[model samples]
Target: MGPIRPTIADVARAAGVSRTTVSHALNGIGKVDPRTRERVVQAAAELGYRPSLRAQRLRSGQSRTIGLVSSMPVAVAGGPSKLGFFMEVAAAAAETAMLSGFALVVVPPLDTDPPLDALDIDGAIVIEPDQDDPTTKRLQSRGVPIVTIGPQQGMDLPHVDLRAPRVGRLLLEHLREQGARRIALLMGSGHRSWYVDLAEVYARFAREHDMPPLVVEADESGGEETGREACAELLEKHPDVDAICAAVDAFALGAVRAVAERGLRIPDDVRVATRYDGVRARTSTPTLTAVDLNLAQAAASAVELLLANLKGTEVPQVISNPDPRLVVRESTRRG
Candidate 1:
């Protein structure tokens, strides 16, 4: 060999510290005195020493990698304005992971059990896991730490979630307050916890109020087109629905289109509201009344909870219950 690369031991020697101290200072792990850590860092910089990731992992038995899996395919989640919330949440999670010295790998939805052996990850974050999700089951069977972005039905994994039932109630109550006696709900056709919770709460609210409960389900993967079609069908069939609560912004935007096509005026003819606030909600014909789910905060909390679990800390079953903010706009305004 022409030249031997400087190692942690060499840096420790130059800094007059132990090899463990040097390791902690370089990796920002463990507790090292501030002055001593500074000296070790400076020595390592001067020596041009780079620690081997493989060696460190061997010592700690951790891959320092995280997997982010979605029940929906990445392509489907990344498609259009309707699925934009997933992208925003993923971006925030990725940033938080990087700050905590971990790499986040976005894995596409698996048709069958995931091959856990192929992934070198210490933990995983599952988004919108359906009941008995195969990927989640495989990861759990492998004894990997997992945190979900939303509650996973039939799984007791820690999660960071918006209060879906509360959001549904809030939207329905707001519509009722806006003088909508005959209201309809447009929701996704999925068994995901959020969808189930929203549907349950909506039905309960409609029953308590003694208003005829009307619901239309649509394929969320089809984006705005699906919402438009669902809303059109609901209006053509119900004809008397005075208000509509879309479980997502995509559906709300589509409902706006359907209303326009029927030559109806928003708020005056039929009010509309959405569960998740986004760009589409803001720029729609009559800016949508929506519940801001605070996705960024939820995303950050999910990563933090996953990191806590990876660090051998006891994570609570529910790390966060994101409060929904109701934003009233032209869509629900009354003259």
Candidate 2:
């Protein structure tokens, strides 16, 4: 027979704390003193004690399972930067959930009306939902927990969103500093918050600088063809434009093609940059400078927030992601 496993009581005794205190610390009930939580964690680790799944389920009436569902189609291979983002986020979420004795399921968008029958999850994280997103409504109607990566237009659920407006201003400011006088924006056609946020920032910057807002919208997921077509048109209309800000790496790569076809040297005749950073951007010609959204952190935070919600704990209505780093590469480095 297997040796007996340590229980929460054993951990509590080792840490010199009550079972209630141990439970609160282990379950992230919040308001526990930092030193106390650390001691409880150390004691639990030393004793190799994990909360029993059967007991936890019976007590909480939950499966201790979490779901991660992205609005964009996620792929393991042969997709764009956004797909890469989804996979990385999923990996992080799974790790975070497992540490808390929860199983993480990567769920695709549901086709039928009722999706709960498919799986019993305590909560889910939806990435980049639209205004009044139907998915959230349907899930809420069935009493499923949801935490979106980006905010829905009017939904009142907890969400974790990036500082998009700040990122937009930072990008424009970077381009302007690079001697890009006649800069053009390659934006997305979607009405998502990030897109709207960037457009508003671009318009405002144009107004303040007294320069025409050279903007063109494209299918963000159209890969190179969409970017190429959009860039070609932008160039055709504003031939003398000195810089282009592609919305994603796909568009940035296409812009590279379009610029080359017109005998333009990137960062010379025309500088280019993109929003999402990925392998494609790093490997592209003149390597596109892009935004590192810190998707992994965002994903982990979403899982934690959902856990808090499930526990009926009080958390902020809106959680803003505090980390976004800009990686400037060869594409926009004018030297």
Which candidate leads in TM-score?
A: 1
Predicted candidate 2 versus true structure: per-residue lDDT over 1-335, tens digit per residue: 99799988899999999999999999999588999999999999999899998887878789899888766522211354444656778888999999988899986533333354576788888877767457777778778989988777667778888778877887888888899889899876667777778889999999988889888877755667788999998888788899998766677888999999989899888988877787777889889888888878888888889998999999885788876778899988987
lDDT of 1 by residue, 136-220 (tens): 8788878888999889988788998778888888888999999999999888777889889988898789889998889898886
Give the alpha-carbon lDDT of every model: 0.84, 0.81
Q: Give the count of colliding residue pairs in each prediction.
A: 0, 0
Query: Total backbone clashes of model 2?
Result: 0
**Superposition TM-score, candidate 1 onto the true structure:** 0.80
- What is the lDDT for 128 in model 2? 73
Compare the candidates by lDDT and give the number of the best one: 1
